[model samples]
Target chain A: MLDLSTIREGDSLPTVVKPPISRSTLALFAGGSGDHNPIHIDIDYAKQAGFDDVFAHGMLSMAYLGQLLTNWAPQQALRSYSVRFRAITHIGDEISCSGRVSEVFQENDEPRVRIELTAANQNGDVKLIGEAVIAVY
Target chain B: MIDRSNIGKSFPPYAVEVENHQLRLFAKAIGETNEVYTDEKAAAAQGYSALPAPPTFGFSLSLSKPNVFEAYEALGIDLSRLLHGEQKFDYIAPIHVGDVITLHEKITDIFEKPEKRLEFIVIQTSLVNQHNEHVGEMTNTLVIKN
Candidate 1:
């Protein structure tokens, strides 16, 4: 459990890494997210589309970042979470998400914290990067 | 090239019913092990009236609209060449299980970078619960590789 009282600016968040994503993970995400874009789950279609092979949904990486946030803070405290897809994450790529406190401030008399976040593959090529603003009080 | 005339267009609003099982499934897919996301008892223990939506849950709910892709097709976009460029969410209020949330999609902006042969369209969707409270807003940018 995260204690807002103990958190300070510049503190590093616990890194969360997911196992290498598989075709089955992408397929399950397709069903769960309602994103049936063949480019994500169908190898032939992905190849036909010029990609080397199927890739995970961009949202999947964003979800990993989200998991990192909610695990360290209260779910209801998230005020904003955003990300930009930087690189394609192919199947079997292990994505690791991490973040650091950017600042601690007050808004409407409530304590808030801003965190800069990143999700990168084993090669260190970032798959996504963004920030999350949370209400810590 | 996608027709630029679709800018500022708004699609009909659609609704998606929040369900605990779906939330649990999504959590599992993303490798989320937090019990609050999958167990009602854990959520209640944490003070949530119901299982609070995972931070990115709104993205999945917004895509459930049946005609979400029709607007892109109408703009002459090649769905296969489309790529997600960016996504942002502003959580104004918590979304709880059992909320029949409505999603309203609006085409906020569209532009192109001729040198890069890329066209970008930004769609913003707002979520309102059955009680008519604004819950969240999600912005998605689709990059069409031209």
Candidate 2:
């Protein structure tokens, strides 16, 4: 069981090996995730649509947060996790993922925590907004 | 004009079986090496049948449910502007390799906000394993720019 008191609101998770977003990495994510949407793999198509280059899938970015949460509270069970895509991520962009504990409450007499998560580039622009609910025994 | 009727209808069930290699590849892509997701022996120690699929694994198979996004063309949806809004999973039991899952989905809710012209729909997809035990559930939202 996870104790919310041990994790402050702004506690940060360990950063993984991340570099400038690339077309190849994006394609790998698409293939592995089975999301073959062209907007994430075709640079020309993305450029024609007003993007500088192919972008990463929003779900790929959000799923990264799952790694973060699982790393922090390995014992807690996930109830739900959701994120809204805010902006497009283009190739060569370095993404930073972060999360903050938002609320702690009880549901059906079980302890739960809500976290607000986000991933952004150095430009101070957000790429995704995520929220998750986890249950801790 | 779109065939509005289909917008709220769900097609027949489709089956999506868990594949160990797929889960392995997905875990590798994210640099994850958790025993629960990588080692069958370790997973069994934790009481799981096999390396349980990760949370978003549903997206890998959830789309297989019949008639997913079939009416988009009729509604003039560019297919290009479509984006995944959010995904939620409710686990009745963990998903493991060799589990043959049959998905039955239904359009549970639909809403259109005037300003956004965005269509919000919820599909509740049930997953039943080879042994016929319910393994997991998936709910997803797909957004299209109108």
Candidate 3:
């Protein structure tokens, strides 16, 4: 849980950097997420679809952002989350998830915080941008 | 082109049981080190009745239908050209292992940008547990290249 007394509007959350997305990770995520889109796992299919190789799933990047949130506060504290896919995450790209407190306020007599999130690759190309609302003590 | 007439069409509700093993696998796949997602004892220590499903784990449950692409297929969407454009989740209650979640999904909107050669389909899903309590809702947007 976040310390409401210390958390400021612009406080940065700890960054979560993931290892380079590998073919094996992609394959495992397919079975785990139940998102077996061929574009994310089959290189031959990707080539047929006009790409050089298979890429990572947009949900996978969102999952990483989810981790970034849960790392700061428990999963149960999350009230809402949303994301927009900005760019494709190609294979072997190392994704770094970062976020900051965008606002702090009270709702329904409970304290809450809104966070702005971003997932980017080693090349500085942002793959996803997101926002999340969490209840605070 | 997607049939705009299909908007507001709701699919048959489907139910999925949250299993501990599935939670463990998903946590591992996402590189999550939180023991509360895998170890029952650790989860209890944290006040969870059982292993708590990780954030975004609901997406996997939503895809558990026998034909994952049934809605898209019925909408005349070419699966090969589809891409996930956006996703939003509103968490109403904490989902845990052993909960049976029934998902009610529907096509909320369908539109296109001819000049941009893009077509968009928006799907909204409401999740309710066996006890009839609303657990969460998901809104997913799929973009198709023309």
Q: Whose TM-score is higher: candidate 2's or candidate 3's?
A: 3
Per-candidate RMSD, Å: 1.4, 3.1, 1.0
DockQ of 3: 0.84
Candidate 1 structure quality by residue, lDDT tens digits, A59-132? 99999999899888887788899999988898889999999999998887888999999999998889999999
- TM-score on 0 to 1 scale for chain A of candidate 1: 0.95
Docking class of 1: high
DockQ of each: 0.84, 0.49, 0.84
Per-residue accuracy of model 1 over B1-146 as CA lDDT, tens digit each = 66667778888889999988888778888887999888889999989889888888898898787766776788888878999999999988888899999999888999999999999999999999999999999999999998
TM-score attained by model 1: 0.96
Stretches of model 2 off by over 4 angstroms after superposition: A1-17, A47-51, B1-4, B64-76, B110-121
RMSD of 3: 1.0
TM-score of chain B of each: 0.94, 0.82, 0.96
* Lowest lDDT block of 10, candidate 2 chain B: B63-72
lDDT of 2 by residue, B10-112 (tens): 7477888788888887777665756778898877876776788877777777654344455445445566666666667665666778878887776666556
* Residue A124, model 1: Cα distance from true site in angstroms: 1.1
